[model samples]
Target: MRFIPSLFTLAVCSSFSIQADNAETAIERITVQGDLRQQSLQQLAGSIAVVSEQDAKRTSAQHLDDLLNQFANVNFSAGASRGRYIQMRGIGERSEFVDTINPSVGILIDGIDYSGLGITGISDMAQLEVFRGPEASRFGANALAGMLNLTTKGPTATPEGKLSATLANYDSRQLAAQFSNSVNSQLGYSLALEQQSSDGFIDNTYLNRDDTNNIDEFSGRFKVNYHPTERLALQFIAHLSDQDNGYDAFSLDRNRNTLSDEPGQDKIRSKALALNADYSGLGFADFNGQISWLTADSDYGFDEDWSYVGIHPDEYATTDRYLRAREQITLDYRLVSTPAGQLGGSDWVLGLYVAGKDYDLNRQFWNWDLWQADSFSSSLERSNAAVYGELTTPLNASWSLVSGMRLERYADIYSDSSGNAIKNHDMMWGANVSLNYQVNNQALIYLLAARGYKAGGVNGDALAKAADGNLTELNSKASFKPETLYNAEFGVKGSALDQSITARVAAFYMWRDDMQVKGWLNPDSGPQFAGFIDNAGSGRNYGIEMENRLQLHPQLALFLSASWLKTRLGNYITLDGDNLSGREQAQAPRFQYSVASDWYITDALTFNLSLQGKDAFFYSDGHNARSKRYELLNARISYQLANWELAAWTRNALDKDIGVRGFYFGNDPRDGYEPHVYEQLSEPRRVGVTASYQF
Candidate 1:
């Protein structure tokens, strides 16, 4: 599997010369909406990936997980129904059970912030933008490693509608609809709704149920645009998602058949509203502002024993569940200099941001033991305020200097039922400077330097439990120091061969101070383990990424992306009294790549084929377990005539055996409870068909 991508990439590149005459097809120009102002993808000085609506439809992706592998050096951790965390450049959380997280990666949907909440369904998404490096100056603390931004489809002026249906293996099914229309010249609106469900791949033999691990999700989005005047525009959006999924994935035999009797659930209910405004009525500058609010509730739990009562005579019947509720409010206002408002031949942007977020959690672990029915409740609140500014000045016709900075203040209050209370406050800042040299209309070269940071916090749960025993643990390690990273990068982006080929290349080196890493804590007496954050003195990560697109013919296009990464962890001591220094960081795969082709066979028929693969890496810190490297193949063919379309798709066509997550523990009693590696497998081969109608 590791040799596949090299051969595939070479074969595709060699054909670029054969179809020289047919290489006139031009690549589409893309706009980056995640930034303060809309800018061309090539003009932005960053490592980014943008997946358009058309590309998503071709892949038949209903969820964010489906498109994550298309980006270089991007990965997700699957500890629940879906991947609960997103990792970039070897940084991000793998799981969050008892601790409140200050995430290294940021997640945004539309005009609202969903940072640290993983991701949501993208049934009506317009595009997905993934920033691969730190965006400290633009995004601040939440984007220490990078960020994911999702934009939903907006309102339209003319009446249009679409209905789509899909069916697949494992009793998977989906139904969706989208419509847009205008009430008048000044008002327009759009709506999208979707429902998806499937009897998951797991088979719970003990419970005699195939749906013990299942998926049922409903999502909707609504948007309205009011353009009453030329200088003022207002857009309002509403978003909702309801999910009820089961979590019975892991097995003692490392197969799909599970023995858990008390299958747990992974459920989330969310509702949000956002109002965005753009006004040019002001004389000096144009204004862009947004106010948004979101409320979400989640229920996640699992059977701790992984077996029924009778299966293991000595095992206790226990289940762990977490019920949480969260609310977030944000206000962002910015002013961009108008053409007449430029100062000293420089353009500037000034903005202010305020956000408030709080969550309450209840953990109930029920067991047959009379005194071990542990019930713990906790709450955390976060308040943030920031002021940021950016300035770009031309140094000549072919060069420019860009600089930006952000100053922010954060306060957090946390408390729990164990008589433990903690308060943390930090005033931090981030900044970036870039020098851009535009060699010509077809190419731009840039050098950038940036600094990013992540706030420190207390490990409440771990600290409370440690106080109950005489374990040798240091108080200084209980609260880690704030993390900071200094990064330097060189990049180039442009098109070539008469605009038939577009490519972007970037190489970066980063140094981390007080790197935050998860440390597994084992109880002195019990098998229960807790995870907490600790400062791993220092670390370094360097990587190179390439994104290329070639217009082989008028009816065909090829996409290629690759990343090579190297990460090293500095000296760090674990809770169990072990030293790990100069070890490769977890989840930081050495190499990752993807190659795809989209071809229009005829006027009404199209075909797409993609192959993606990654190198194996360590699964966690303080362990030697690793996943096996693997490759996956996907293909789709669609035929359209008039307003009707039919498509058939298959993913992982070869049915390769691969593991997405792994754990090393002593869970199986059959072998005297000896520790062995257990893995959660990736999806096998799946085939499906889709039908769509538009009017």
Candidate 2:
């Protein structure tokens, strides 16, 4: 897949930027820790994107999932909506049981890791940053494929608040309020609350299930900063949130428009605290340290008799519980602008990281006074120390070369509820090099290559016990191996026609060794399948990405992005000697394209429109019964009066019937059932109004 944007397109975009605003004026820019001279998104040698607060307001995004779904390179898994489980560039959440993510993509909120679905949603975020390629060489080990970084709003100097109320067509009503205050010269605080209720879109096929869903959320954040002196400061942050909401409907048959009797429900809670301190201009080095902790708990339930026709009325309830907690601490020392040495002007960084987590899960069926519980528990601890440095040397007036490397060690252990134990230890190395040539101030081209890795572990749920003994170990079903990726890319980023427009294009090839696949098999207790982690033989992913942003006069702007991917797997052999060749990776569409446009109209009135399209994807490894291609269109209209703004928006305006359904490990065609037993449908035409104020 090769993408080449014509010069005519560039010229047209440049003409539209004649009355544009400064790109960095509305953003809070921060330096990339290791490379202080490189631009945040434009000059970096990796794929990166940033979402501004202004953009969020234009879209009226009330939550993190709304923002993620609008991005081109991102794909959301159709699940129960406890929270969004995402797949980026073909990797993430490969399993349906126990809410297990693929472990290749890393998610962080305010620099704190959110390991599971319990803590994935951030209710009051200010901005979200996504790095598309292998950022692990700079961010961490877990970001083998990419990274998602979330930033929350901090306390401001304002001392006012606003209240809003809304009503919609879907039997929906909403109310929200926000307040901000400055406690003193050094302390600031902000608080927010929201409540929403709706009568769902589908009918509950079973009895005794809730047809109306309601959600109430509360969030508060506090910050205290001491700028007692310049160049040295300390900041403290604390955040808390609670959410309770009813699950959306999942269709059992798309052709028949049948819904489940047991509509899922969820209860979720989360909290986080962190402290950061920094000192610059030290005689020898600069020092920075941060420590943070987060915890989440969730409860989910579904009806067991929703599908069976003749089951007793008493056997109508079933449920699952997933709980997770995580903590992390980090410290770093960097030597900048060293004096009188061979490495003068070069940067060096040494860091130490320590983290730990615990996971608990249980599932059961509810029949009058009879309860069966299948439980699993595991613990994880990790300690890593690394030293990394980058050096750039000038070859000529038009060329320069940069090189860097990092070395680290990792160790982990997994213990199940039955006392069975598995441990792993390994030392890994990662490195990168790039050659950059300056074509002019408006253009630059670079070629780079790098390697990334993800730690391996045993299936936390693949344990069996014997009745005669306290615990027994079953032979490991799959010899899971560490996943490693090697990537080579060539790209260009630049601003043209006097910085009125910006554009980027890149082409790359990435290969995965020992990939992990969640092979599904029908279980005895229910109709759904459980995820069994196995080592996929081998696979290759190659793609091209293109993005453009143009300012069509002062109050108008436009953005466009597209991705083309070609992925294949081979050597996948099951215990039965069956081979999986010519199979497409799950949830990875071959072609995706997106475009968005905005018209300010006036300072008081704004209009926005966006569109996204994706090609068909194979839900099963056999490349049979693939999902149909789909497209979604969204529009927004806003009007401002003094300090308040009112907006109306519609999502999925076309009401396209989108479905993500397929057979897992084997095909199931019941006599009276359809080809796909159960399928999750994307939300249909949704319309809402919102009001916001700033003081």
Candidate 3:
């Protein structure tokens, strides 16, 4: 429980004897894509973390969620086959049901938005940047909590290729390949393909099957780059993915063994295309334009009863199914002036964006014993137009100011199968201001204040109707207010001992108004549960984070990262008149820490060890149940010879039983509806070998 002090002491002792050097290092000059332009990570006046391709390879992460879980102040809710929902600083959705949701965090892959559905396949990645706190000035409504920006490898002029395969415990297997080539002086291309399968950890006792919760996935990507002239560059990208995974997560005993005879399926198929152009022929600025299109079809269903009819003859066997198809198109145009050359001695960027989306959803709930069924269908159309600008100027030789703002107009139309329609529109804005000071060539400090917001929308669930059975009154209760936050932060980032040691420390405080909280409500006479969002009065959150990396010796290195957070609700009362004030938010852990070390035994052999831990936290706002704190230990050993490399790895070496997600409600009919806690556990200890070759 006292991980913060332990990590701090270790970092201090390791970095105390470092000597300052004048040589530049790779970490000091790392470029980050936090905004539209690329800048050194140290120059950014925010909290940011980056994971490189080399880091991904060393960890042997098969998906984006696996890689992200290693960082500080990050966690995932794993009810599905994989960790598809992400929570940062305790601000995100915990689960998704038969209703529309506005995500707090935003996810982008190669400039294409993938919010709410972030099943990103990890392959051929260049870098991934995680920006904590509010990023509304750059990303608008989707970034109320933060943003995750992912960049893939681009086309290279040299001909290169890679082939890799992995075999692991639990009958897991993976195959992947990548190739890049330059056809001529102006044309270059890159292609990547991957396929993976696994027999999941859970078992179904009634069906006598071990693969009820299995994994099968395939993904491919292609990119093309063309340079017609010195001032003009064009790039095209396409991606496709298919996934068919099982979802038999829960059981009567809250263990890995399930009794559901009718198992569920989690499937998704997606395609994306994008084109980007950059032209520097403008008189005083460079012009950039991008157009992108994406489509996804997903099916998520589950056996609601989690039991066979033979076991519980009196209870009705129930099943729930949902299907969704979505399409989106976006266009963006921007201009960036030459740095400190025009626009009144300040660097400026201006841009305009337009986007549209069409979404359709269908849900079916059936009870076999009673022969009762409820079917619902809905369609949603949305559009957005925004204008944003940023300006940066130096007030003194060591001090600089950065200011940015975004103004957006949003419109939505929702229609349901019952002939009920709702229309909503709003105009919102967000802003950011930061002042940074350079203490020396190796250190910098900054203070920032920002505002973020999420737009309101209509609810289409039939159970959301008014108790009075009045249509007009029902429509009035179907809407919720927008949520907003004001955040203030201070941080210091720098290198010490001649760039041999790097460290960053930050403290942040945030105030939220009109906070949106989601829960289910049961009416006095309804057979279905109604899901609704209410505007909670207010809340406050504060946290501190620290990270340090030290090169202790030529063959050894050490890294430590830790976070401490505090949260409190205010004036929020549930439907049962239960006061929620002073309660901690769900999924908001108090302490998280990660420590890693790497040793090079020889020119061809290396070893890595990592330990990570997360403190206990509440599972939901409607329940008092909490999860237990857990820790994991992992190790890897790799050997390299010419263009071939081999590695062996083990995760969760200590085999700790950590509960990643939990629900505190009655799930079994045998106990006569007595509520009990059910939990989904984290992955157990697994060992594997990976072999890769490059040319």
Cα distance off (Å), candidate 1, residue 79: 1.8
Superposed model 2: Cα runs more than 4 Å off = 1-38, 95-102, 118-124, 157-201, 208-217, 255-263, 308-342, 365-374, 378-398, 438-443, 465-479, 523-530, 575-578, 620-625, 660-677
lDDT of 3 by residue, 95-211 (tens): 666667787877888888887677556768888988888788888888887888888887888999999998999899999899999999899999999998888888899999999
Of the candidates shown, which would achieve the greatest lDDT relative to the real structure? 1
Lowest summed lDDT across 10 adjacent residues in model 2 is found at 465-474
Q: On residues 101-194, what C-alpha lDDT tens digit does candidate 2 reach at each position?
A: 4367777766666644423333355667777766555655666777777776666676867677666656666666666667776566666566
Residues 112-140, candidate 1, lDDT per residue (tens digit)? Answer: 88775656667678889998777877787
lDDT of each: 0.82, 0.60, 0.80
Give TM-scores for every candidate, taking all chains together and pairing residue i with residue i. Answer: 0.94, 0.85, 0.94
Q: What TM-score does prediction 1 earn? A: 0.94
Better of 2 and 3 by lDDT: 3
Candidate structures ordered by lDDT, highest first? 1, 3, 2
